[model samples]
Target: MSPILLTVNAGKSAAVARTDAPSGLTGIDKRPVDGEVAVSAPGPRGVGGSGLAGDSIADLRHHGGDDQAVYTYAREDLDHWAAELGHPLENGVFGENLTTEGIDVNDTRVGERWRVGDELLLEATSPRIPCATFADWIGERRWVKRFAEAARPGAYFRVLRPGTIRAGDRIEVVHRPTHEVSVAFAFRAQLGERSLRPRVLAAGPALHSELYRNATAWAENA
Candidate 1:
């Protein structure tokens, strides 16, 4: 895998278009190929425009973030997006903030870690469940919900350190913690009865504070 493929988007216009008000078929691949994706820092379009500025978004976690945003590939579905929009991924349909080459975003479980450039450290946090915003883009209210049921979720991050991310940057796997609990596992656990929740509770407070908060709750409930 190529490690990372950082991309910058064109602001809300691009974001909403993909998720809600799609522009119909545009390119040859079939789906919405490309519109905009944003860098952690602003781009030529600027922060409000689409790009981030001077590590501003990274700085949002000066204290710590409960979740981080990361994307991965699920080519089959992507092909649907491509085919529907007549734009291929090669055409940049996702407007993904970053299009990773090496790692599958879905594979990024909570507690996972990676190194970007020299300074910033990216770690998987809670998986991003579908939201209304996503539904707005796809034009189907259930698409977001369906995504959660189908793919489970994508990794979000809590920045361990802040720095710039660029296209083709080397994303090094620094660590993958040994744990019985992962975000997806947790959600699956929630599907029926109490199974993995107890395990998460048992892990104790050694994990990131954010996780521990959920763990603490699960422990109590379990």
Candidate 2:
């Protein structure tokens, strides 16, 4: 299958009664939009939020930044989860800004570059670490544990060149880093695989800053 941007999702902040969101509101309910959505580096975490203009990021401390300006998930992974959970999973249901097809998002190497449509250039940076907000939103027992064990956290991207993206945009892998550290590998390393920490660190400056710091500490202390 040809890789494509299947949908662009943006969310509005809304109250969710039982969520772990500190503000009692969450932006996990992203919905697909037909129109173009602006994409850019969102400055920094806790200060800058979602890169998508219309997207709402409730937990600024955890969600958005230049390194994680955009969250992407593969439709194939979603289908896997849907089948495992015995429920239909729709595009954007995982709170990802971009729903992609024909791309192995988890296997995408850190520092890989993807050209969306024509102008938007995105660099793969990190993997989404499931949290309480995500677990609460999903409402599945031990959802976090399950998701982590599966090691298919999808991929986060930093906007290298700001532009507009829309549903049905073609996605082309413009570059792939020489390193073997992929999003899934980094995710597993972060989840306590001490042996993989060195490999994850080898991805160098392309890695998310926090992950780099943790890997550095782990290597030093090991």
Candidate 3:
């Protein structure tokens, strides 16, 4: 089935937080919303204007900005988690701006671009690296380790074209780079397997700028 946006989500404030949140503040508790939302390039913190129009990033040091402008998660993966956790996994619960259906988000390669609705163009940049904030948000024991081990971390994107995005908007793959650095591969390489670091180089400069910098730094030090 063709991938479609299952939900459009955003947050107006950083109210979604735990008293003991690792980062001290977190915007990971996004909720779904109705109507159309604008999608655009990085704004103050590299956040897109789409469904993430007012989304806030608590830990600017690590999350949000250009390469991490928008996050997309798959309903299929959410379903898996729902089954595993024995509870319902709602859209945007993971702080993603786009909850997509029928997309192999984990398998999508870095640099692949998707056109949403008429004007939004987003390019996959990197896989989310679970953090203490995420673990605390889910209230699951060892959630970070479990999520990393699963290797199904969803993808982050950089907005290429600005436009409105709403639920049921169609997604079309407009560009797919000739690289093997899928989101899952990149996630495993960075978090689980150091040997795969070299593989990330195959993605070239199209790899997320931050990830590219990290890989370059690793290479320089190695």
Candidate 4:
């Protein structure tokens, strides 16, 4: 697996990001790591927090999964964006604590689970799509909408048991779901796939409740 950069932040600029913070990512393996995270996410920009409230990574990541990590990404994903879009997706590209390689993060489904170590169980909960904040940061609105259209939506896993996660941990997909709820399908439903909403909602409450809440609301109004 390709080695990716790792970073940790006790607090950020609250305005900027780097510059006035201690880079916890470097001392990870006791080496001057290659790719330092491009940015750091704490309270709002976290994977689950919705950028609204809370201070912990757990508060940020959806389903209240792990406290220390809110978002994670593959170093390759960052490289791909940098090469294609002329900008790199650094600092755990979606606010993930553990940036990995060789793991199919986008191919996960709600209720799906994986075992990372002796006690860590990461389960696929929901898709973490672009939000308004992402648009503001990237300086484009289409990536968010386009991402929803492209369908390779990234999954958010709830940490079942606590365990120490390092930079080079191999995250294997132990349980794959039998559903076909791709990002495209999610967008399709968000656009008009009303019929399938209820079923998707029924499968995983923790995963789909947000979307499920909307689905039911739409269903009642319809």
Best by lDDT: 2
Q: What would you estimate as the lDDT of candidate 1?
A: 0.47
After best superposition, candidate 4 residue 15: deviation in angstroms? 2.8
Best by TM-score: 2
Return the TM-score for each candidate structure. 0.61, 0.97, 0.91, 0.62
Candidate 3 vs. true structure, TM-score: 0.91
For 48-150, candidate 4 gives per-residue lDDT tens digits of 4321122222223232323222344555555666776776666544544455666555555566666654445655556665554444445654777765655
Per residue, candidate 2 scores C-alpha lDDT tens digits across 86-197 of 9999999999999999999999999999999989999999999998888988889999999999999999999999999999999999999888999999999999888898
lDDT (Cα, 0-100) at 18 in candidate 3: 56
Error of 1 at 155 (Å): 0.7
Task: Count backbone clashes in candidate 1.
Answer: 29
RMSD of each: 7.7, 1.0, 2.4, 7.9
lDDT tens digits, residue span 160-208, model 3 = 7778889999999999988789999999989958888877878877788
Residues forming the 10-long window of minimal summed lDDT in candidate 1 = 24-33
Candidate 2, which segments miss by more than 4 Å at Cα? 18-20
Clashes of each: 29, 0, 4, 10
Better of 1 and 3 by lDDT: 3
Q: Which runs in model 3 stand beyond 4 Å of their true positions?
A: 15-23, 44-51, 220-222
